[model samples]
Target: MIPKYRQQFNQDFSQEKYSLLKEYLKQKSGLEPAFRVSESPIFLKKEFESKLIDASESIIDQIKTLSPDLLRKAVPDNCYVPGHTDKPHFLTIDFGICRSENGEIEPQLIELQAFPSLYAFQKVFEDTFCEVYPFLSEIRNKMPHEEFKNYMKDLILGNEDPENVILLEIYPEKQKTAIDFVLTEKLLGIKTVCLTKLKKEGKKLFYENEGKLTEIKRIYNRVIFDELDRILDLKTEFDFREDVDVKWVTHPNWFFKISKFLLPLLQHQFVPKSYFLHEFPENENLENFVLKPLFSFAGSGVNLNPTKEITDVIKDKENYILQRKVNYEPVFEDINGDFSKGEIRLLYIWRENDEPPILLENLARMTKADMVNVDFNKKDAIWIGSSNAFFAE
Candidate 1:
């Protein structure tokens, strides 16, 4: 997000560079990126970068303590079931932050997802960024110690047969993020099959490959329970919660274990103050907060600048949360000579038998608007949704 790098990179930006980027992506992965790749790379100060890692570690520790309880409540038959339980195991947490009034870049806990995110395409994006813009000296922000693809494979197939494992999703071809599933299939050598494509008999899940039915031993779950609930005619023989035949890559319980609803309860300094909209303390002013749906993904249903009426009409009050907004520091300088706001999604994978969560991938989002969502900044002059290239410290 530094201005100097943008000036240096954009001075050489041209139509030829864009063409080269497209060709590089097509040659490297046989796919074109869905989003724009910036001419410049994002740079993070050492102090701020360290804080980001500290924040992640702190949140993880809090999750470790409440994981058991949260997992127990995630079950359908449990006394404290939040909602549906058809999909389990995959989870992602997005931290939104900005420069505070005091000049410190602090993180505000943003959206936490219980479903699969753009895992595969993000890695591809990183590789493409490095390939197309190798001349940029500031390209190194945080180079991953391990490739995310290998890390994901290790996490999902630990002590298991890769042939028997399937990445589960619902009508994956219909999903907008189907590209990621395709990449996952290529990298891990695991098949990506729809839930409907799965055949079940006597408590086991199986899918046909080349006219042969292969038994499923483990699931790299990408299905969202909310999406599954919308389909009326879909039928399955096994229950996701009660079934014991398949193990999970990311256990279903962690979705609830590390969510925005639980962010305020955490003792981490990186997480801003948050509370359920219904139970928000009267003493705290609502003006400093943003309203968000408890289970929405990709910045959906988030009211960045909520009006009083909007807050008043909130149905299912318990299903909403008001979090103090973090002023996104316009850190990235763009081609148009304007600073762009940015947020870093540091990806981690906690595998079975591993003592700690291993950092896997890093994705950076750049926007010129007040908020980072694609919808809010589509018209911004130099907005580029891209990946960061990390250099060793």
Candidate 2:
């Protein structure tokens, strides 16, 4: 972390500025985000930034060197999507601060996702942060706003007409992350169509927009199979497993293949010891372990402390993992002078057959709890949900 910037930011931060930040969010998106926005942005030094970047690259290298079968084994049963692309179009690697043996601060890998993150919203949020903090505007947008927008357009729309490309989600308007969907539609000029709204005929998928039937050529998919599985009677003409004639911006199977299922496969200095719950070694202690189900999102079904009793009730051993509980360092000071733990999520975008994915931009979270979720920080304070990280050169 950049100490100088931290001190300056903390000294300059005031409740009035937080009020302005909220007003900016409302003015830009016309609706408050369903999630919390931290009171301050993180000021990061180049050293820690490089550590995160290196850890992410190492994980990517380790993943790339794995054999095809080894990689395919990560996919859970009955979750494969057809027309798999050469690589994932989007990647997000999360890192949180933890103490090393020598008591020095180190970045530990939290989780990684091949699916897209809040790409469009982060850009706008960063801009608004800079706007609110005038002196800090010189810190630079991690990814240039105009350039990032164009890159998103390239990844989401490619050469196809925006009309033919749809940002597919499951009733996106009602979702908690709907602010991102709204901004995505405005930024990319693509309609956000619900999964049930799609009509499939033969091999073609179509959606009615503004009383006109439009053929879908590409989909910026936001639909998660786990969420889809919850609905028994919700009828949708198009299914994720079907071989529909459309380009998947990011093929759905990558979600399972690159999610928690693959976390144990990754071994790095930053990555904590993780193992399949079924194969958890008897000699290895479970004291520092947290039992996690493979497919849940937003930290659901994660047992903070695991006992034999907890593991006994697990229906499927293979579907669970025992991951070491990381001690998130209280890195940033908040309003009441109480320190807050921070997590940095490095977002990546891979274009076609690129060897290594490019580290495009990043977003940080400020939490005063065990994990970086809204439930963890229920006491209410700054730095709960979405925050920014500015790298000091």
Query: Total clashing residue pairs per candidate?
Result: 11, 2
lDDT, candidate 2, 266-380, per-residue tens? 8888999999998998999888888888988888888888899889888789989998888988978765778888898988998885778877778888888887886777665
Candidate 1's residue-wise lDDT over 311-385, tens digit each?
Answer: 888777877789887777776666665777777777666655555566666667777767675556665456456
Residue 203 lDDT, candidate 2, scale 0-100: 91
TM-score of 2: 0.96
Model 1, backbone clash pairs (residues 3+ apart or across chains), number: 11
Q: For each candidate in turn, give its C-alpha RMSD to the true structure in angstroms.
A: 3.7, 1.4
Model 2 C-alpha lDDT versus the unseen true structure: 0.85
TM-score, each model?
A: 0.86, 0.96
* Candidate 1: stretches off by over 4 Å: 1-4, 34-40, 74-93, 113-116, 136-149, 235-239, 307-309, 312-315, 378-380, 389-393
